[model samples]
Every structure is written in C-alpha cells, then in structure tokens.
Target: MYKGERMVLRFSRGQRVAHWALAVSFFVLLFSGLTLMIPSLAPLAKGGVARMIHRVFAVVFMLVPVYYALADRKGLQALITESFRYDRDDLLWLLRMPRYFFGRVKGMPPQGRLNAGEKIHHALIILTFITISLTGLVLWFGKGNLSQNEFLGMVMLHDIAMYIMVILTIGHLYFTFVYGALQGMVTGYVNEKYAALEHAKWLASIKAEKTADGKLPQSKSA
Candidate 1:
C-alpha cells in the first residue's frame, strides 16, 4: 500500500475469520466422523469420544453460514448472488477448466470474483450442508421418536453427504495449492498482478470504482 507497491484485499477480515473457523470445525468433524466408518480407527474414537467431538464440530460447522451472513452481510450476499447467476463466460470457463489443471489459465474466459468452478464448489457445499445437517440431527435426536427404517435411511444419507464433502474438499485443496491461493485467506491480500490474471473482471471493477470515487471501495461494516 506504499506509493509504488500494489495489492488488493482479496478477503476481508470478517470473511477470513469465518472461513478459518469453518475450516477448523470441518477438519475436526471429518477426522472424528471417519472413525465411525473405519473400524481400525476405533481406538482413536474410543468411548464415544469421537462421536462427541464430531457432534460438537458439526454444530460449529452448521452455524458458519449464519455467522458469515451476520458478520459480513455484503460479502456473503454477493457470493450467494454470484454463485447462482451464470453467463456465457461461466459456460466457457467450465468447458476450459480441464486445461487449468495444467497451469494454463490464459486462454480461459474472463472470470468474475468467483469463477464457475468456485460457484459449483459453493453450491455443492451449501446443498451438502443442508442434507448432512438434517440427517445428522435426525440421527442425533430421532431415536425412539422415529422408526428403525427412518433412522437407517437418515444414516445412509448422512454417509453419502460426507463422502461427497470429502471428494469436494480434496479438489478444493488441490486447486488452492496449485494456484498458491492460501495466502489470500491468511493475509486478506493478493498481488495485483495475480488478481489481474485470475480475476480480471473483478479487478477491473475495483479499479473503475476507485477511479470514479478517488478512493478504494470500503467493505461493509460489521
């Protein structure tokens, strides 16, 4: 932010906090939940400790969206809006995404702040959260209140959702590492050059707004 240095705020403080909180809670849930499915891991989850930990983290994970909505309303709303709305460039980006695995991004279509792939990831997370949370709650509290068949059905759905989440998380980490994007989450800033190359439309919009107002746009206050 000095006279010659250039950088952009890729994530705000509130967004960063919410993101890491959810991430930590997710990992805890994932490890603990995995013990239930893998018999060899039983000792680690012995005496129902893992189940207790899983349930605790599950509450934190499920509340993340609500926390984000309250803490960073504008950012959360913008992300939600962008995730559900797509255009020609998004379609083109989807078609060209495989090339991105090879570090070839130049020929890809111009991307908004959240690209098509990111939108899909977000959509998957949202849907998974709903399904997993509902099934989890039923499993946790529906005993005696629900039939045996109904309980078993919820358990099946819960496992399916967890598998989907695990797959998506792997892909998410792969892309994040390939792009060296973890810094943005940690520092809330990204190099201007990187932003220009990866999120041209969003960077251009920010510059345009700064030019028009003679100052950078401010994040909505929590």
Candidate 2:
C-alpha cells in the first residue's frame, strides 16, 4: 500500500525472520557437510573445522522449526496445510510447468497460496529434513555403539538426504531469481498483480477477507 502500489502481505514479520534464519543456516550446513564428504574438499575441514561448523549449524537448523512455530504458529500451520492440498488447477499447472520454468507466469491455471510445484517442493524438503535429521542423529550419537554396516548405512542415508536437499535448494534458488520472489520474503509483501498471476486463488481469498469497512481481517497471511 505504500508509494501508491497496492501490496499484499505474502508473509509476516515472523515468517521473514524464520525464512532468513533457515536459509543462512542451510547454506552453512551445506558447505560444511560437503567438506566432510568430498575428498578434494578435505582440506577445508582442516583440524575438524568443517565438522565443528556442521555440528553447530545442525543445532541452528533444527531450532528453526521451533522458532517458526513459536513466532507464527498459525502461519506455520497454514503453510503445512497448504503444502499438502492440491486440486484440478494444480494438475493443469503441472502440465504447463515448463512455461513457468522459463519465467512465464501468466495465463496459467489459477493457483493457491503455495501452488502445486511449491507444495511438492515443500513436501520433499520436509521429508528430506526428517530423513537427514534422524540419520544425522544416529550417526552422531550412535558412533561407537553401531556396527560397521549400520554406521555405513546411516551415513549413506544422511548423504543421500543431503544431496537431495542440495538439488532442491538449487532449483529453489533458480525459481526465486527467475520469478523475482526475493522481495516477498524480504518484506513480507508482494504486488497484487504478481499475486493475481501466481496465486490467484490465494489473492482472492485474502481479498475476500476484507471487511465491510475496507479493513483487512486480522490475519497473519493478510
């Protein structure tokens, strides 16, 4: 609503903070974890530096969910709910996903707040997070107790989960830049037009929440 541009609150303050914390902690973990895995990157782990970094950020990484839950419980709930729900428009949208990949967002099927691809992405991230965390815990705490085969298996699962998340994060970044989505996360707001194009159903729902006096309803997703 500033500068005469009608803006929509795509995220809230709590959400923005949580998003940045997650992003920062994720990248740190990615690099440190890579250092531990790749022989060529072994030097980067000099004197266990990378291992220390990885372990420390793993704590931060796990704490992010708790922070998000406390800061914006309703928003977290909404996101989880939205990320699992899909409809017919989502099917049509998937068929045209290539157009979206190339930066075309217009004239596609109307989407909800989290679109279909986004839902899939979030769902995958959630699953991988669980996989990585559980395997990571076993590998960390069960070191001396676990047999060689069990240890190796846990390590394999942990690495696979990390690789999958790395791939997803790269795609996430690509789409972020292609679609210019950074602003929404930074400011918790987005242009109405953009919302209409990328999240028509969500925008309509938000707009419909407006009161008779023109005030937005009390909502974290306003």
Candidate 3:
C-alpha cells in the first residue's frame, strides 16, 4: 500500500493571478485577431474598439513574463530552463505517447516538476508569443513605405502565428478546463489521490518532504 497522504498546492496566488491575466488577454486577442482574418468580420474589428481592446490585452499578456520575473525570480529562471531541456527519455516518452492514449502503458514516464507535454506546450507558447509580438508591432505601427510584398508577408506571418496560438489555446483549455486541471489552478490545491496516480514522481517528492518536515516541499523547478 502507498503510505503517503497526497495533497498539493500547485500554483501560488500570484501565479494564479498571472495565469488568469494571460488567459483573458489571449482570448481577447483571439477574438479581435480573428476579425482581421475574415473579411466579413472586418466590421467587427473596425472603429478602433477592437484595436484598443487588443492593445490593452496585449499589454497584459506582455506583463505575464515581467510579473513572473519579479515575483519569483529564481523559480521563473528554473521554469524557463527546465521547460526547454529535454533528455533522450523525453523523446522516447513522446514516441510512446500513443500507448498512453490507448491505456497500454501501465505507468507513464517519471515526470519531474513538469511533464513532456507541458514542456512542449510551454515552449510553443513562448515561441508564438515572440512571433506574434514582433509581427504585431509591424502591423500595429502601419507598414509605411514598404512594398506590397513586405506588407503581405507580415500579414501572413501574423495570421500564421495567430492560428498556432488559437490551436494551442484550444488544447490548453480542453486539458485544463474540460479535463479538471482547472481545479488545480482555481483552488491552488490538487487532489492528492489524483497526483499520486498521475504524477507519481512529484507525489513521492512531496511525501518525502512531508516525512522530513510536516509541510510540503517548495518546488525546485516550477
């Protein structure tokens, strides 16, 4: 029998706040950005309302990194570093993910603070944010004196970035909101039993810390 009690505060209050800001801002960007893609929706994007809303949310989204840096500098650094580094094991895990979906793998890889899927998603979000911000600035500032080719290129790039973000957002929402991860964010506490089953390595570390000191361990890598 597992001799461990399982309860965890996954996200702190500050982190939760930052996540909400990022989520809301992304939604606003998605809706307003979509108008630019569909000409029939152009009217919805006009009159500066959508543009203003987009800019406001854009600023909020940009501040997620700033707040994360200031709130927990070390944790933020670790998250960035760990989210990118992938071992051979992680690649193998990706290859075997099909087994997981089919319930053939009895146990998944021993995930660290974040799993392979989370790392991939985080990396994609970071890349998309950079791409959108750069392309958005070009369009926002009015591509003046540029050739039609240059203008169209920026537009196409921006649209592609938006599409990527939208797809990721859908996945994120489905996994988090629809699949119960949202509770972890909303309450900051995850079901211990669930953690033990889904995140055995992390649960073990938590139990170890609890055994040493009647408190949960601070995450080495958030």
Candidate 4:
C-alpha cells in the first residue's frame, strides 16, 4: 500500500476466532480419523486412544456452528445468505473460473465478498459438515441399536462427508496461498488492491457506509 493509504477490514475478530476454531478442530479430527483407517498407522490407533481423541474432536467439530453463532452470528448469516444469493456478475465470474484457477484474475467480473467459486465451496462445506455431523451422531449413539448393514451405511456416509471436506480444504489452502488471502484471516484486514480485485462490491459497500468522520463501520465481513 502507498504511504498513508488505509488498509480495509476484511474480517472481524469474532469471524477469525470462529474460523480458526473450526480449522484446528477439523485438522485434529482428520488426523485421528486417518490413524484409524490407515494400515501403517494402525499402531497409533491401538488401545482405543485414537478413538478417544477422535470422539473428543468430533464434538468440537460438531460445535463449530454453535461457536460461530455465538462468536459472530452476523458473519455466519452473511456467509449463508450470500452463498446462495448469486447475481449476473456471479454467473460471469463462474464462467471465467478457468482464469481464476490459473491465477489470472484481473479481468473477472466484480464480485461480492464471496466470489462464485467461494460461494460453491462454502455451500459444499456447510452441506458436508451437516451430513458428517449427523452420520457421526448415529455411529456414536446407534452403535448397538443399528443393524449390521445400517451401521455400515452410516459409517460410509460419515467417511464420504469427511472426504468431501478434505478435498474442499485442499482447494481452500491452494487458493489462500495463491492469492495471499491468509493475511485477511491473520490480521482481519487486507490490502486495498486485493479488496478491489477480489471483492470490489464489498469494498464499495464499505465506502458507501463510511461515516462523517471517515471511519468505517465496525461490522462483520460483508
């Protein structure tokens, strides 16, 4: 940024806290789950230790929504609402996704706080989390009540949901590094150029809401 040019707030403190809480719990669950499934890692799963760890983190994973609601209800609401509310520009942005994937993002249509790809990714994450949580509950509580085939089906569904989240996380990490988006989550702010390039509509909204003293509103992201 040029000297004296202000950086824009991209995420609020509550938003970042909820995000990191989800991330840390998700990774812990993933690691413990892998130890249970992988042959070479079976030694780590012996004595039910890994199972216990998995159960503990599973509760944390399931509580992510509650944490987000308590921490930043407005941000969570915006994420859910904007993810499903696409417009003409969002469609245009989706059509130019190949360019985005290749890191050539300059010419894409202006996007809201979430671009089209992010909308799809966030939607899938929310959907997969719900499925995973439900299946996990059944596997945990219905162990004795469920028949053999029914139990197996619930386990399969749980694994599928986990696999989907794993894939989504990979893509998410790639884009974060590719676009230097980690700064936003880390500092709750982003460079003006980045805000313009990736979230012009959101930046404009912020500008429109600037107060008489030129201070920005203390609201959640988007």
Q: Could you estimate the TM-score for every candidate?
A: 0.92, 0.92, 0.84, 0.93
Task: Rate residue 217 of model 1 by lDDT.
Answer: 60
RMSD of 1: 3.4
**What are the RMSD figures for all models against the true structure?**
3.4, 2.8, 4.1, 2.8
Comparing 1 and 4 on lDDT, the stronger one: 4
Q: Compared with the true structure, what per-residue lDDT tens digits does model 3 show for residues 80-124?
A: 887798877577667777765454434567666666767788888
What TM-score quantifies how close candidate 4 is to the native fold?
Answer: 0.93
- Residue ranges of candidate 3 with Cα displaced over 4 Å: 1-6, 101-106, 217-222
| Worst window of 10 by summed lDDT in candidate 1 | 213-222
Candidate 1 lDDT over residue span 47-141, tens digit each: 99998998889899988889998889998898778888888999999999999877788988888888889999888887888999999998888
Cα deviation at 36, candidate 4, in Å, is: 2.3
lDDT of each: 0.85, 0.85, 0.74, 0.86
Error of 2 at 203 (Å): 0.8
Residue pairs in clash, model 4: none
| Model 1 misplaced regions, further than 4 Å | 1-5, 217-222
Clashing pairs in 3: 6-192
